[model samples]
Target: MEKTREWVITGADGLDDLLVDELLALGGSEPRRLKGAIAVQGDLAAGYRFCLWSRLASRVLMPLLTVPSGNPDRMFDDALKYPWEQVLRPGATFVIRSAAAKGVSTHTHFAALRLKDAIVDRFRQRTGDRPSIDTENPDLSLHLFIEAQQLTISLDFSGDSLHKRGYRLAQTDAPLKENLASAMLMQAGWPARGEGRLFDPLCGSGTVLIEAALMWADAAPGLPRIHFGFDGWAGHQAELWKTIRDDAVARRLAGLQRPAPRLVGFDADGEALACAHRNAESAGVSQWITLSQRSIAEWRAPALNSVAACLPAEWAADVTGAGQNYSVPGLVATNPPYGERLGDEGSVRYLYRAIGRQLRETLPCWDAVVLAADITHADALGLEHKHTLRLYNGALPIFARHGRILPAEPELPLAFEGSLDDLPEEGMDFANRLQKNLKVSLKLAQQQDVRCFRLYDADLQEYNIAIDVYEGRLQVQEYAPPKTVDPAKAEARFKLALQIIRKVMGLHRDKVFLKVRERQSGKQQYEKQGKAGKFFEVREGQATLLVNLTDYLDTGLFLDHRPMRLRIAAEAAGKHFLNLFAYTGTVSVHAALGDGIHGGAETTTTVDMSATYLGWADRNLALNGLPDSHHRLIQADVMAWLKDERDLYDLIFVDPPTFSNSKRMDSDFDVQRDHGHLLRLSMSRLAPGGTLYFSNNFRKFVLDEALQAKFDVTDISAETIGFDYERDPKIHRCWRFRHRV
Candidate 1:
């Protein structure tokens, strides 16, 4: 709407150069570095474009005028000299935000008030009335920056901080502002890495990876935002802005079509990873990110496979090739837990040490960037950085250290890390029971055509663990012993159980993955004892699904649900099926597959809270020749989703966790307490004569008798339990329900 005008762009202090580069690249020129900001000259369109394209700027300001400050009275009179009628319309609302230097006014409030009064008085004098002051959501936002006896009044082009980006709907504790995270990646030479993975090992909520993905995709950071400060300004160019916005959309589409580099993130905290998944999806980059709940201790290269599978079909070969061994050259940029945030110095040191070891021992030939709280904590990494730039996360000064990972050294495998002597006892009585159980379980599994089954589930209480066989690999899960049992004794027994498995099963260490199951307080399906893993395809009955033995406590496929899936396939012909709290959509796929008995289902809707699981569910459905048109995957809390759901389904499968409390959800859920309400909601959407299959892993779960009175109900746990899972009949409970006549 106007010719070139002076604009100041503010960002994190240490990243001014990056902001300057962005300004020049976005139709601005002659950028001059200022304290905490950069000054540039640009037309009105450039100001709006920077708001959309700049990933590291906090605010963009267009200075209306600069005048020297005398006393308060004289400064107010000078402020009135600006033509108020041109800047403000009669009865329009505006707000003034200001910061003043000591030389300008000792009282910042007094300075701001004087400026505010001058604007109002000028409007009143020029016209018949003054504009109203709307502090929140004002039509116009004026900013005053005063220093060295000079005041520069400007309009804040960004109504809100540019760091909002409108993507982070969920977050973890001590999150870095979006702009600061972008600055960190820029300092580390990210999108510039050109072709390698961008990994964040301790990616709390995935701010860094999300920013990196959005930038790489050429998606304007502010493209999704509805409003800007300039929208209400007199000079906003609606047509020019529309043209720029349309071009940005086209650029994003082209960028998405190109092959995207692998982006991966991992965290020990399941809640944080869940937040990250939703954040990436909100940012439209979930398809470009691989997120898993994994401990840093399990971090190692060659084991980290690329999980982002949404790419051009032609490029799948290259992506898969690089993922097989993680041989792609990349940058490891992460902000790990440090003392100030974590408070425990010892734990912080331990985290940093583990990070350093992984970088040096596993990620050879890769460059690394880490943001740490201070030098003391940073040094704990035991890495020699090539450069360290001082910066601030909000107000806390931090350091971004860049270094090249030391070439990996040759390693010798340990015999179970620390071989427990005197535990196996050659022929322990418990070992004998496990051997017998395994033989029976294997025989039953073979006869039933089960590739993955629970072989031994604490058959003997002394060795309290479950050994599962997935194709040929074995995953031994040690269920945490009750507190009444001695810790040392349990540890000894677990070690002995492993030794016996090696001898009896004749499997090497490489073929076995270990997970320790502990009673959890969060979503246990998401929160698992399993470590990071490379997922592989597994054929179960008529459909192929992906599973990872080391990824989570529950393999993406629930072996216990085999009979239920068979039931779904038999009953799903021509019926619209709904699977609520669907973990990996195995049930939905079975419904779509139709089990050689019924025709394929008419439609299927799978709902789950975790975006990670939903992604897997989609791949499962697609693998089984199901199209997205008829098979829809919805990511939402089932409880909340049910209220707005109106479609009626002929066959409904409802399975929920015993207890769950997610930031993505409205409230915490207890299956026993909420089942009645949950079941009633599910029943509302059931078509006449439709059947609902409800199940849960909570051992003590009892179906509410009231549901029986309201709807026809039958206990089907016995029928759904396959031969392999018959031993632990109480492992899970199942039921069948229908509307009463």
Candidate 2:
């Protein structure tokens, strides 16, 4: 009988199509989409080739046999009867993993353990010595999928999940999975070949940019991975794997275009930038990227012509391949911060508003694709939305807003012709101060050449304010009242306020749009409302840090941590970093990129208890170039992992919540009460002389008296926090620790 081989590729949610297309492009048979998976028919050699080259696949499994069984014992018996000698060598290390969908089995682990016993018994009965189970790093991996009593046992031809594309050496909190990163880049419509800059403004570990560099160079995303299940399979084809690798290498060499466009990342954290640079180095593309440590406000685009001139000759040829001059236009793409799981509603809104402002002002001609949950935020950019593609970063439904800046609208006279006394007696002072603040902010933004600035006064009553700053213009409006008697009336009142501000500044009425939203009770309530509001009015040329202060506790910016995220991406090349208490894992993604010169591929691991936050972290990782294999997301308590696992990491981020009950670990974690213990435990897992970044948002968190005795601790809070944090300068405290031992 002719041998028939089947392969499966796993991916993030909604990525089955990309994986299928990738497989077909590689000459595999038509791929069939399954839940979170893609199946294809090919020869063993083709399967191995797929394992080695696929970028969007998480794992490539080769089915060895399928058996029908009604019970666990029968399933084991059928699995044991397989030709074990053909697949497993005597005394080799192996592991069994099982997944049971509905109608198949209820206990997945139990099913997996049974299969393991069967495989071992088969080996032992024949050879008297059995392959030992090596779960962490198995020589051979077997995957069993049971669906409705139909058992499918396959050898994980891609060994470690295809997501682990061997380039990463360190990790941080909630890093993006490698495959998901690739998928996200694909979804973002990242140009396959372009000299235009690809940026991850909130790059946690440099996953998005690194992936873009790799894809841009036609480098196989899995080139750095060391092992594959095909390496040990009975029909393993070393020659084919070699051919695939060699072909990939040859393509990379031939595709080497000169003066690649600046693949840049910005994060505020120095450690994160260091890690990103290190990661880029590991990925072997550090030379193709640029890393910067600056807040979004400080970020300056490279000269347009300079960036355009950096395009390789070949890219010009390829663009001309379609008979068009290859003048690669600059494009700004990023996974901006959202309030979900990463920051409070206030911080997320502030972040979105800031991003909108930056795109509108500094990158007017440049195209931008922003992956955000609330698509309405795109209106804040003062740009016309050309298209919006729907995608899910895990379960968070997001819209990829793609557009270029629209021409400036003609100015109109203020709609209101009334004096301050015309306003309600209760709101007269608030309105006057708000108008004054808007004027001051607009002037400051223009003076600083800020394309988009925010003017907000959270403390103001009746007229809490937010303004959008644009070139030669300002858009001012009142935040929605805390509890509105009539939202329509309140909105009208806000419009009047805007007109008053416009008239005061002698600006056109078309330059400003007033927005009002009723404040809700809690964070979830606010998120629902924010999502419901779709788009809020964006003030042009406002100088404050946040655009929408009253939408939630946080406006659209987290100005304080902007520097930290930028720094992490700058330095994350070719290093493995860990992010603990990675709320949204923004820093972890930044550190995955090496310094752009070498385009490093660092690995990152993000840990958090909230699945909601982890989902956001995963999206951040995907938005960057980090692959699933290069990053790990653990929905477990950090303290428990410190106690249970002995894995040593190069960079460790220990940013813990102030206090919380962690249902995942079944314990109450108080950073103040237990930070010393937590820090000690995390440090114990750090690689020798590795750096441990410990931070807490608690303003009152006191350092443990004993911590200084064992390690070097430096207070980096001042450097890490940017200019936006107001209430208490010490809202969060960060310390860098280096092990003495």
Candidate 3:
């Protein structure tokens, strides 16, 4: 008999519960879950068995010390007192890895260097020889975690992550890891009690099916491994470990004698199917798995009665026990593709709808789990998902939808219904110019598949107003005429321009709207023009934003900033993004969407002064399937908040008004006078190699001369404004800044 000790097992982000279940089934006691790990009391053999058989774990750690450090220096002193000769052999090469613990130091490399010094000094003080340090191939692997006020030191028992099961020699372009696959399987109830049949419609490289077969045969996950961290430990019990592993091999042989479980997989790529066949063969589970090539949109599921007939001959012949009655529909689990493309969302949505249609109509009683990264695609499925697991696959945050498939009503796609309008007569000069502008702008809009864009921007002298198309409706703005002009003449000309616009576009009177614009600053710029609080949804490149054409002087989205918004989306992935004065959080949404909709920024923080605008920002995020959990929204004065923030960001956008006065503000803001101080504070929060964009709509705004000598600033006004906004080059000025390192 061996004594019991507490052991810690670390798993993936969302698999702690599954880890506890596996640990309990493997002869462990008092299992408890942690943030990203699990703890249990087990003996030597218990730990060895789990290291060999448990499939849903990343590493198995053996703790040496756990204590609270009220002082920072005490942690280093405590490490020197720990017994290093007990498990670590003399003269053996070892290395220590450190992760930046929160509320402590932000430099992880320095912390790791300090920890190494204490261990070497301890070994030299005790023995005559100094232990060698080998980072590439170390004999012992040490882990040091310095959390807020606590310190945990442990030895890495499982070397080279347990997810590398040694069977996947060939894989698809984006293959799923083995442990994540096992977690999905357990969540779908495979081999739990009556876990019988399983199917994968979009199986790539056969990761899920092979994991399922391995679980069914009761085989060890570490059987093919040649090395572990404990191999060089002086206190390792080799005889005890061999006995435990031999018993597992005997159990695996006996389990193989029984009937095999029904497992099937299909993929559209021939090369991917070939890799799946090769991988299954390497795992020695080829006989129990079936592979096929099929397209999702064109393929349909087999009836419940004919399932057994379609299976392989060997598995189909046996209709008893594990292979029996296959009358019940089994689980369908798979991972699908998603991302942001310029004009390819329609095709992606079609693929997801096809997946939902087959699951609902062909397989009535089956349970299914699907991994999709885009929320819009998941909605296209048209099925009520009972449970959703949000996790990251590479750089993408994806949702795993689990539910029972049943028939549901499908949504019909809407199309435009209208005839082309006839050209106006030769005398109508304003109408002729409007049609010409539309010829170029409308074609560009259609090529990009965008539904909202500017059609005319004061093209003719008499009709000096901007016209924009939102979906099928129109917004017409009339700039206040010069004071010298006669009021009667100005009013009559505005009416004529309105009439021409209505005739040229074939729009009803109710479909068109008009607003009068004047030189505004501060609170007047955001004042409401009308109380028609209605909002309509419009599509930009990859984001669907809400636009109110009547309530405020300006819509939620700034049409002039379209080019800059797209640039943010292209460069925001895996970076810390910040957006100041984020009116409605449109740019923040683009940052989260990143490069089809697949990748996005690691996190985004949006700050503004208006609570009403922040509430609107929150709604805009929800429409894009984004939660405030990762994208933070704060309501505060931009200038005050900038001076107090200590966190650093990789990308920052600062777009302020030329002049502003608000009751909540400390003082009235003038961009020309306050920009120097505002920019300095914002730059202080920029991380190394980070970028900050400064933009304003004031026509007379100028960059301060002192800024050029202190920072690396480049005026990108010509680049940030798009072709539609080229007519008015001075509509806004944009500059990119960086630290002068």
Question: Highest TM-score, which number?
Answer: 2
Q: lDDT for each of the candidates?
A: 0.78, 0.63, 0.76
Candidate 2 lDDT (Cα, 0 to 1) = 0.63
What's the distance in Å from true for residue 474, model 3?
23
Model 3: lowest-lDDT 10 consecutive positions: 314-323
The candidate, 2 or 3, that scores higher on lDDT is: 3
- Model 1 residue 527 distance off true place after TM-score fit, in angstroms: 39
lDDT of 3 at 306: 43
Q: For residues 1-741, write the lDDT of model 3, one tens digit per residue.
A: 899988888877767677888898886889877666889999988888778988988888888876574444666688788888886897788888876444576565666666677788888888967888899989988887767767677888887789889999798767787887887777777776224677787788999899888888888989878887777676789999999889989888987777877788876577888999999999988898877654442233332234432333332212223323343356777876554311233335545665786566455556677877777777766655667766655556776777666543343222222322453453278877776777777777667665677788888877788998887888999999999989998898888777788877777888898888778767766567789878776667656577888888788889989889888988887799999989888899888776443457778999999876676676666555453446788889999998789999999999998888987789999999999988998999999899999999889897888988899999999998776788888989999999998
Instruction: Report the CA-based lDDT of candidate 3 relative to the real structure.
Output: 0.76
Compose the digit string of candidate 2's lDDT tens values, residues 24-141: 8876896787876888888766776687778877788878788775578787888789778889765578888888765554677887888888888888888788678888887788
Give a tens-digit lDDT track for model 1, residues 1-741: 478888899888688777888789999998898878999999878988988889888999988877776567877888888886776655668888988654444666777899899998887787868788899888888898878767788888887889899989999989988887877777767777636477787789999899888878888999988778887788677899999999999999998887876887877677888999999999888998888755453344434443332222222222222114443367778887655554224335435655776676555556678888778667756654677878888888888887766654443221121222344465467666766776777677667677777788877767778887777678898998999999998887788778888767777888888888877766666754545747665666666677878877677877788899988888998899999999888899888767644455778999999977887786666444354546788999999999999999999999998998988899999999999999999999999989999999999888899999999999989999988788778878999999998
> What's model 1's TM-score?
0.53
lDDT of 3 at 322: 32
Error at 639, model 3, angstroms: 53
Which lDDT value does model 2 have at 215?
Answer: 79
